[model samples]
Target: MIISIIHLLSSCQDFLDEKPSTDLVVPDNLEDIQALLDNEYIMNRNSDMGEVASDDYFISKQEWESWNEITRNAHVWADIISPTGRFVSWNALYEQVFYANVALEQLDDIVPDSNEQVDWDRLRGSALFYRSSAFYNLLRIFTMPYHLVNPELGIPLKLSADVNKLVKRSSIEDSYAQVIGDLEAALDLLPSRATIATRPSKQAVYGLLARVYLSMGDYQKVLDYTSLALELGNELMDYANLEQGNTFGFKRLNEEMVYCSYFSSGSIGYSSDTFILSEIYESYAAGDLRKSLFFTQAYQDGHVKFRGTYMGNLYLFDGIATDELLLNRAEAAVRLGNEEQALEDLNYLLEHRFEAGKFEPIAGISGEVLLERILEERRKELVFRGLRWEDLRRFSGSQYEKTVTRDLDGEIYTLEPGSPKYAYPIPMDELQLNDMKQNPR
Candidate 1:
């Protein structure tokens, strides 16, 4: 008998003529599985509640300095302990994982003759990739240093499709182990490439492994995975070929992007106006096309207007890119004490950024200096790509300082790390629902 499903927001219930679990069901066939996978992609595309609250992209500009207060208290990301902030991020991330888990649980039921075995593997791999991605985000935000050897505090590790059970938090090492395990499995199952950008491929899995290894402080592993991703021919987008109104005009993600989220004006619910820090802008030398290609200038009543600057449109199409792999390789080279190799990768990136013959290699640079330069390039290249906050947390103890200065109404305000409001507080509703421990103020 044919059954219709009524998708509800909160609970799953069945009607006489309808199927249970309206939002999801055990696929009767391969086409049903494909449809369910499409739903997972939809979740990834629309999951912006976390990104909107994070500081990777836009912050309260001078016009709305007071808005910073709202962010600082409610969405300002510091530690993963804030009930409101953590709950929002945690719940959203888990929700994505839930969709993935449900899809994975139903994989074996599909008839092999009706579905290509490769397709089944791809779907399973994509589901695992999404789950790992969500968990990795949680680990970066909630846990302390991943390289702490043995971390006392780590985020909870959720693995099953069942949501009724209460899951306790795992140690940092355990969480990383699980994340690594998931990615490795995903790598084995995913295809090398796909016809569409929304799906995760084998190369995307490798890209994630490179990022995960970098976070774990395994430079060699980072290098290995990054090199594998690069072999896929995901070259950096040459700004020279870019034209106005090109949907892929911005440098954040393009053919180079391994996996990315798509963003539009209506979906973002915020102005696209982007302001580059003057110091960062000044760091770019003459003839560097990134300064012009990546940003636009507007002058209004003596005040500069930098509106319509796209900061890695998340909702447009999020994917892995070669640029990140290049940065990862450069950083890995530096860590591996290969100063020359690191410089080569850094210069390769800069050469593409600047006009031909304008790029030059620095002399007498040590590994440490090369490392710094690579990071600086990353800061410039990856602005608003959801990498800034994670970069802040990963390199917290490094020379880089987490600070932003704002001039508002004749008063200057400076925000620094370790401030009483570094991390956001957990939401009140979460505290009421679960007896979970809150981050110490």
Candidate 2:
């Protein structure tokens, strides 16, 4: 994570620390730059605050108190004393931003011969993907929904390799626009798909654009991007084929995963939820593959625990996959009143997710009722992939409005649909040091 200064490593100085003085070695060649982007810990980790703030899981009374002050406050929708604290997640993302900046600024200097041109393009394209991805994640926690975003309240837009550049916030529109540009650039540079899921590909680029445009409330564009992405990659994981008794059934770089990344927000992660949210757990029909493939009974008290993360064992996943694109494309199809198209996409996804003989095709439903059913399936299918929080916000104030409330101990903490509290505060340390504007509490 890029802290006070972005250091291009030599040995082990941990430049991501808020206060660190380390020698900054500029990576001059494609090999050095590719190696930097491949440092998974520094380049790939995202702040877990979005997951913590989201309604997918809950913490126990004991667990809540055990968390640090910053996390505890965030969990309850309260303001923290220091914004730069771990839970706010500003620095960690910027660390990735900084690394990408270095790559973009320096990689062009290395002139590859005909043989290494493809490698060169892939390395640079990966950097653009990483930077855009980091910025998008930052926007999720630090700003209000697109409809409510004020120009002055956008997160800092860091675009250069210069470490001493003054910090400033871009308008929300400009921030999203920048991400779109970066992603499009990546799409042009990358292959149709990477050999491994750790790297970005043209498919991942299109999928992320679908997600970004969806968040910005552009359903048609979501469909447009989804169409392109699906052409490149649309392989869904078949739960029926998965081994029944494995502790973690999925593997990294699975056929369905277009991109793979993980983030840890302290102890509460993929395997940490002792109790699956009842509504989500019960939504599964008896024959639904997700019911058995995605969950298990806890060893301690027999409470339901989630063991199946698409990112494989031991990590909270926030990556792109074909299944997510299907949901978005279906939702767009329904919105556009293309009933046949919508049902075709929905049934295709559902057929693969249920027992072979028990699967039922949704038929005859139309208009709003059909849309609602599809949305509900989306909510059930995409849980714990770090998407429910955005879904809650997106549905709020519309026909599908939902109010999420968390009960911890005796007090009730609620996040009303379309509430200002949904946008978390930017870390105070960043505000002070960068002269940055803070989001309304």
Candidate 3:
């Protein structure tokens, strides 16, 4: 009987030693836990949210129609609400949130003596950074302007890993507060740099904070964070180095990039095809390297295909760059009446873009003129980088009369600020599942 019991115990041990099914592998140890970070990084790369939020894409088909024809059908109509489009902007972002929560939850179980504990901390910080970024995008799309100060009308904040639980929408204030909290926590934990581009570092956290504060209209905070990010990030990519098919890529974590992610051939189409606005092409000055490096004009049988090539794509890189910090700081300075500081940041970007000593300083420029010049410079410098629409929306209160024109089925449509459809409708799913209020169109 005792021999039989010993044999049974041995059989049980053997059963436990066998590999578990894929679904059963919940990252039991430090190594297993590290895998979650890798998985989340891939999810971020493949997410459609980035493209959807890009200036090249529109929140609504109507808005697309006002921009241009190719963009009208491809992005506005087909990419936003179609079955293929499927509100990816919402779903993909929330998916990252869920994954981030899962990683954060498991991080505490990792022991310091474990070989992977340091890696575990890095992973945790990355997860939190992603979580904050996802929510920031969601808030940008789903909620009204942060300046509204209405908590009752914010987005649904998902803070946990449980997919089964129902989540109600939080106030806009609460959602942003949560985003700030997560980013701050991430900043405290993330490294100054990492071997991989996908992971967030302390500089990435600061960059994110600057963006968030800019969105919130907190110019002081924006200036502070933007300065910190600029100090840590590398210099801009030199246009002189760019040649046709040459690898003149921006260095990761160099002065230009604070944090970055990779996208091979598979992840190329969305931003490359859809985001470059026709007006941007028309506005490009002759002899500008940006017009050459950033876009290519192709003609076929009287039809033109204006293909945009982001420097990020050709170079195996994508991320928030420090130039954004310059723009943010400049805009904040303009808002705060520090015109000299504003001009300084603006000229800094222009000097870099125009090659050394080519950019001359504007003399005695002020008021709306300086603002307009800054806005135009921003349009030129930041084109195809996914910022135009948000800049329009965030500064809507300024009553900028910039018009967007697009062609749909050969019909031209015009969109101006103060249109009833300026804001997007809450997805029907959210309306059905939660009692959240929708934006009035």
Candidate 4:
């Protein structure tokens, strides 16, 4: 079941590059495989490549000018020509995929004793989860939007540790199928809950299922997974207990956290020169705690910066959380005409987010209006959490259709919904070496 590179490339190539054929590095025993999954280098979130492409952030012209060529191209929605110029996340993400495949491929030879079965299953499940996570995000970033998915090749589905397996892009449909298949396989083998946020438990699996189904617009599926996730890990951080004026109101591995992974960025995007949408930032009711808890006035005049990241620092946190599951459930419930359930879920999260006694439950809303309100709360609550780009993509054809435009030095850079730009060009180096066809924009 192992698939990896068989051919040798130039000496300059890194892990992302295909190289001379070599035997797959199978771990000798269960603990070695456990050690592989424990390698956070592959498990943790990579850089802010997708975050920079997202609508939530904007950098000044000076910042843009100083970026390397690839970065600047990506910043402006230009087809990237030099991958070295872009953030190195693609290489980083795939490295995780390859290592996960290594662990999974090695598992076939191990015969667990009666007492060893539990740990064996957990290790296999963890490997699958890690592999599935990497592929899911890769497809999200590099492939075309889901609705447009067809036979056209998406990112390569690297399922083996053996370097000899060819890495060719599968069709978008096949890509999703593999990802879902992997995740489904991982679910039963995982523990009910992981010991820590970094590990995959049944809770993280369900949370991931919600995210996957949400991306595919399967509201009922999203609701089902979210409900299952909350059944296990639904602790919400009450604003009443939060300490204000800190960089993060929520701490690492808090109850609300199902799994923790983070993206990284510099201070430029955090600055207020390009401000939060006044309307959105001002939408918080007087008693809402997020406005104060998540933001601070930037040194720039009339601008504000985001202080609330679940990572509790400047790095962008992108992991699954209970609050996100609630929002997903609310949105999906309303979409499925479960208004009562939607309201119940929304009220629960909103209650925790707003000042204790000042929080008033939303009432009398129904249908699309109720859905809009839920979606609005989602935008307000999850800003800078690495969901915006996908949100923009998913809403493109709906009434929520967005056309993102940035004014930089009097010039406008816009990313339109349904445009070819929506699928960022494959890295130039990948196109040069692989059989994969570049996205025609």
Candidate 5:
């Protein structure tokens, strides 16, 4: 098992404490710059706070009482205090932004010859994509949902490598604009496909844009971007082909995975104490391959837990994938009143997830009903992929809005739609250092 930074932090408090020191050797060459971008710990890891707060899994009352503070508070939507005495998610995401800025700044000085142009462009394109991805994740967790009325302040747009400089939080609109702008710039520079899934490609940028536009309710862009992405690759993994008896059935960098990344393994991640919610487990019909492939009743008490992570192990995969693109395209199509196309995309994915002879295409659905079906599948198909939190935020105040609840020690805690808690309180460490406005608690 490749224990990611989230796990490393559990034992190493100073693991990510390095400053962007000017005293260190500067990366002046293309190879040096590429090396910085290739550091998976800095670039591929994302915050898991959203996943911990989401409704896909729960901790038993006894386990909740025995777990760490971050785990207990995150599950109940309460204010979280990092066990390492630092907000891991906030610091880790910003660290990615910092690394990206370093590469981008260094790239300016090196003029690649014709022979090196391709590599140069790929490095710069990758940097832009990484920065944009980091910014998007930060906004989703620390800032208000894009659809909220006069959404709260956005996260700081850290564009430069200067550690001494402080950039205050921008308005929510401007923050999203920055994310979109960087992605658009990356599209022209990136190749149609990358040699490795860890690297971003044009298809990955399109998929991410579709996600961003969906959060902003720009159905047309979501439809357009997803269309372009799907045209490049729309292959879904056949769950029936996976070894159901294996502890983790899926493999890392699977064909459907356009960009491979992982999020933090929070205190509740993949533990015996953390069991899949009954509602979520039962939603998968008997013939649905996901029921067996994505979960297991291997616990001594027979509680079902997720073992089907795309990373092929306990590390949570939270990167771009074709399945998510298909769902995005389908949802956008239905929202645009093209139910036929929407169902075509939705059923295509479903066919591969069901038992060979048990699969049936969905038809005779239209309008709001069809839209609801797509959303429900989105919840089931992308469960534990760190997307449910964003979905919950975007669905707030809409017809699809839901009030998620948690039961710990016989007390129920609820997270209401459109609540300010949707945007977690900005870490006090950041506020104290930067003097930026704190998000409303």
Candidate 6:
């Protein structure tokens, strides 16, 4: 039954029209349920729009002109229209939600004996984690920032595997509440650590909780979750020890990875013509090793390209990691008036990124200055990790508000803080099939 389901899911090219859940035989066993969730290609991949719309990198005018209309529109913060009428990110993420719902529904009826209890708990926990992660990713791209007093409509919350069951878009507040509730529920069900990085463990849950809360600007919860996650394992890879010139500077699922996931690859993000912004590349100080380790001069004109992703390939690493947790802890601590702890975590992480002996600690700072330092380091350290867009959205109207702009052929396109376009429009096909409201362009 599971094999048939896999075959059906893989063979379907259009997820929105011919849904994978249609006329499927449900798998009843625990192994089959785990297999459904373990399809990382389907479950672990997330939206790439965050990276494509981010300000970290830019493509040459010639290259941008030749790209698809959807990619070009996304890069310039314009209303996106898919020429092919397919939205891979939206379809792929909801497919993950469907698989998770299948696992959760199956677990409800299966009662486990003493020997099967652990596996039962793990499977249930994994399902909840995956669902929560997918919802958060969808919210980041399709919905407005959580800190907004009155956010726009969020993506539809499909809690059932029935493709015939239509779900409406939930309120932004309700959407976030669902994600937090699911993660909180899974806290006790997951083990302290998973056998592999791809599976959800207690540490991964904590890390993801911190990320979600950070997006919502709940600083206290961010601090608590980051603290809890670091307690499990807080190892940071030393940049000085890596082969800076190697094609793949970081190994896949390296020591810093708390959870393993990748963003869907897009030409805007992975193209050879995509070059890192000069401002960002030049910001790394003389002793900083990340400059060489994270980028390469891909053009004769001194234009640099990002290559330091932990995925060890063109795909962006969108998973939670210890370095991000430390930065989250630092920012949250300072926001909550724990400057001492904030500085400690920030400087500790930076020490590993610079030349071993020449590393100087960031000290004697507090208030907004300390906060900005942490945020700056975050931009430098987590480059091309499918996070900058989330940060930009959450920072809207704050002291760190940024106005992103793109220049093409002597014309400029700018996206201002708190703009409605921050919430991208729903895919045309989705809007046609469902009654959900589209975000105002």
* lDDT (C-alpha, whole model) for all candidates: 0.61, 0.79, 0.62, 0.78, 0.85, 0.86
Question: By the TM-score metric, which is better: model 1 or model 4?
Answer: 4
**Which regions of candidate 3 are displaced past 4 Å?**
1-24, 40-42, 46-86, 114-117, 148-150, 245-255, 261-278, 298-318, 355-357, 361-363, 401-405, 410-422, 430-435
Residue-wise C-alpha lDDT for candidate 4, range 1-441, written one tens digit per residue? 012222222221544454344542447799898887886645776555556677765667887777766567766787663556333667767777878877777788888999989999998898888888888888777776788654675788887775556688888888888888888999999998889888888899899989988888999999999999999968898987888857666677778889888774453345444456666678889899999887775536666667788888666688999989999999999999899999999999999988769998999989999999998999899988878778877887889988888778899988888777777667776656666787766
In Å, residue 384's CA in model 5 sits off its true spot by 0.3
Flag regions of model 6 displaced more than 4 Å.
Answer: 1-23, 83-85, 149-152
Off-target runs (Cα >4 Å) in candidate 5 are 1-20, 80-85, 149-152, 298-302
The collision pairs in model 4 are 2-160, 3-160, 4-163, 5-163, 8-19, 8-20
Clashing pairs in 5: none
lDDT of 2 by residue, 161-217 (tens): 666776688889888988989998887789998887888889999999999998888
Sequence-dependent TM-score of model 2? 0.92
Clashes (N, CA, C under 3 Å) per candidate:
29, 4, 16, 6, 0, 0
- Alpha-carbon RMSD of each model: 5.6, 3.6, 9.3, 5.0, 2.4, 3.2
Clashing pairs in 2: 1-95, 2-95, 83-427, 83-428
Clashes of 1: 29
Give stretches of model 1 more than 4 Å off.
1-24, 40-42, 45-87, 147-152, 244-248, 251-253, 262-269, 272-274, 299-318, 361-364, 401-428
TM-score of 5: 0.94
Tell me the spans in candidate 2 whose CA falls farther than 4 Å from its real position.
Answer: 1-13, 17-23, 81-88, 270-273, 298-302
All candidates' TM-scores?
A: 0.80, 0.92, 0.78, 0.91, 0.94, 0.94
Task: Give the better candidate number (1 or 5) by lDDT.
Answer: 5
Cα displacement (Å) at residue 36, model 3: 1.7
Put the candidates in TM-score order, highest first.
5, 6, 2, 4, 1, 3
